[model samples]
Target: MVDRFVEGAEAHAMMDRLARKYLGSERFEWLMPGEERIAVIVRPTKVRHIVGVERFRPGGPVPAS
Candidate 1:
């Protein structure tokens, strides 16, 4: 995940994106009670698969993962 703090225009843009995604409908807009907003950006990390199922079965040897 992307672990970092953001500010300025970038943060504002992100906030709008979040608002659209979370409170898209007009009915849901009421849920947004505050003028100011917070945005969070999460980047997916590479999935490192150390071991696959093929390495282990029934009584087969279990590979180190």
Candidate 2:
């Protein structure tokens, strides 16, 4: 499953949930939370980037300027 978050706190929470559901509670391989936008990188299975609200804008450029 892909994890997308609007805030850092949410992303962190999603990461924990996903790891527990998929990789198990003791697994450390999925420790790295992607970013404001994260993707599930299951090589042989699937590789996709899950974009979040942070990556969207309302009719304007949303750069961190």
Best by TM-score: 1
Q: What TM-score should be assigned to candidate 2? A: 0.33
Colliding residue pairs in candidate 2: none
Off by over 4 Å in 2: 1-5, 26-65
- Where in model 1 is the C-alpha error above 4 Å? 25-65
**lDDT of model number 1:** 0.58
TM-score of each: 0.35, 0.33
lDDT of 1 by residue, 31-54 (tens): 345555445667778866676545
Backbone clash pairs for candidate 1 read: none
- Candidate 2 global CA lDDT score: 0.53
